[model samples]
Target: MRSMTRRNRLMAAIKYLVCAIMILVIAVPLYISVMGGLKSVGQLRAEPVSLPNPVNWNQYTDMLTGKNGSFWPKLVNSVVIGLGTVGVILIIGTFAGYALARIKFKLNGLIYAYFQLGLLFPLAVAILPLYLQLRSFHLLDSAIGVILPQAAFGLAMMLMLLRGFIKAIPLELEEAAAIDGYSRFGFLFRIVVPLSTPILATVSVLTLVSSWNNFFTPLLVFNSEKKYTLPMGVMNFMGEHAADWNLILAYLTLAMIPAVIIYVLCQKYIVAGLTGGAIKG
Candidate 1:
């Protein structure tokens, strides 16, 4: 019994050690970045790992309202694109997920398999064709160009996630609503949608993050400075004289703020949405 107790204690100690190490690994770089952002170029180079002695604030201010155009507009662009992408994904994903989960149709499984197959195609492989297609429609360098492709790419995964969650919901609810003279659309809107808020929030958060962070798509589609998204705007910080490492880190941190806020605000829904179906099944 004493030996068993000792073994358990040993395991507990190891677990704590492992957790501490993991935290340190994740936190150290973030700390460095934050500290670096707070330092001058010279100070940063001299003491890259050290905490800011006096805590400089110029980096953030300069980055926010620098001569190369204010970051506010770029920030707004990111928000708009992110929100637009989420809206499109939600509308399409909800309906498709519901169909896949409940409706009987020919080759449903095969159709869904095709969607799964889409996930295998890397974005790089399709860039040239996508650009050509968008160009034909005069959508190249346009916001809609970025939005449509993102929505299309995101649909498959969103459908799979929401479909799994929807499957866990009992079909009797739909039948009951139908008997009450609710049209199919009404039943879907009033019943399934209201109940699926958790998953919807999860997908919304995911879609927003993905769209906001997307760089390559925006780089390819948007040529005008005014329409550039946050990631692309950050790229402009790069230069010869002084790489503006301070400003770069500051902008990077700022770029991440929205995603972090969103995740924190909707975390409970995300967790519940992701896990609810798993446990129920």
Candidate 2:
């Protein structure tokens, strides 16, 4: 028993050390980006790793106020595209998930399998065909171009998550609602939706982050600089401000803020939704 206790303590210490290393790996780059943004060009160039002695606040403000290259416009574009993708995913994924979870049909398994195949593939594999398809449709360079493909790629995961969570809902609750004169659509909208809040929040947060950070699709689709999203904006900013490391850092820092805020706010739901979905599925 004493030997076992000693082994457990040693394992615990190893786990803690691994966790601390991982945190440092992630946090150090973020710390540099944020603190470097607050320094002047001379200070940042002189001491790249050091903290800002007296933080300069103007760079962030200037970037926000459009002194930088189309910063606000790019930010707004990202917001619109991200929200649009989320809306589309939720609408499509929820209905599909509901059907797969509740309704018994001949092709149900086949349909689920088709979507599940998407999980085995990444978007990079389809970018060429996707780009060609968008070009053929004249959707290239439009927000719809970005939105449609993103929604398509995100749909499978969202459906799986929703389906898993929906399956966990007791069948009796749905039956009880049905006996109470609730129509299928009504029951879905009123009962299933409310009960699936954590998963919905999870999907929303994930979709928002993925859409916002998406660079490859946008890079391929958007021709004009004005239609660029935040990630694209950062690239353009880097090019334009190549000499000014401080301003570049500031832009990068500002670009990261919204996603961080969103994740922080919805992190609890993210954890609950992921765990719940896994267990239920």
Candidate 3:
């Protein structure tokens, strides 16, 4: 018994050690990025890992308020695109997920499988064709251009997440809703929606973050620099300020703020939704 206890202690120590290392691996780079952004170019070069001798806020301030300001526009573009993408995913994905979950059909499995197959193909594979198609429809350089394709790519995964969660909802709830004079659509909107809050938050956060950080789609879709999203804005900022590592780091740090805040706020739902879908599905 003593030997078994010793073995368990050793395993626990190893697990803790591994977790600490993983945290450092993720946290160290982030620390450096934030710290490095607060230094002068010379200070950053001389002491890359250390805290700023005097915290500098110029780069961030300029990005926010200068006449040469481009960051705010990019930030707005990202927000609009992210929200639009999430709205599309939740609306379409919810309806589709509900149908797949509750409505019986011969091709139900096949249709769901078709959407799953979309997971196998990343956007890079279809960029050329997607570019041409977007051009044909005159979607280039528009918010709708970025939002539509981003939303499409996101739908499959959202459906995957939402379908499982909706399926786990008790049928008796629907029966109760029906008996109350609620139609099918009414039951879905009124009952299923409120009950599915966890999964909805999960989907919104996932879609929002993915859309917020998307570089390739925006890079290809927007020709006008004015319409560039944060990721593209970062790249352009880097090119214009190649020698200014501090400024670049500042831009990166600022860009990371929104997504980080969002994820932290919605993290609990992410865990609950994923677990609920997994256990119930």
Tell me how candidate 2 scores on lDDT. Answer: 0.90
Model 3 residue 166 lDDT? Answer: 89
- lDDT of all the models against the reference? 0.82, 0.90, 0.88
What are the models' TM-scores? 0.87, 0.88, 0.88
lDDT of 3: 0.88
For model 1, the run of ten residues with the poorest summed lDDT: 272-281
| lDDT per residue as tens, model 3, 1-281 | 99999999999999999999999999999998898888999999899999999999887788779544488889989999999998988888899999999999999999999998778889899899999999999998899998999988987778888888788899999999999999999999999999998789888987887898898999989988899999999899899989899999989998899988987888886676557545654
Against the hidden true structure, what lDDT does model 1 obtain?
0.82
lDDT of 3 at 11: 100
Task: Using lDDT, give the best candidate's number.
Answer: 2
Total backbone clashes of model 3? 0
Clashing pairs in 3: none
Q: Residues 17-132, candidate 1: write the lDDT tens digits.
A: 99999999999988887778798888888899988877888877776676533578889888888888988889988988888888889988987888877678878889999999
TM-score of 3: 0.88
* lDDT of candidate 2 over 151-190, digit per residue (tens): 9998888888888779899999999999999999999999
> TM-score of the candidate numbered 1?
0.87
**lDDT at 181, model 3:** 95
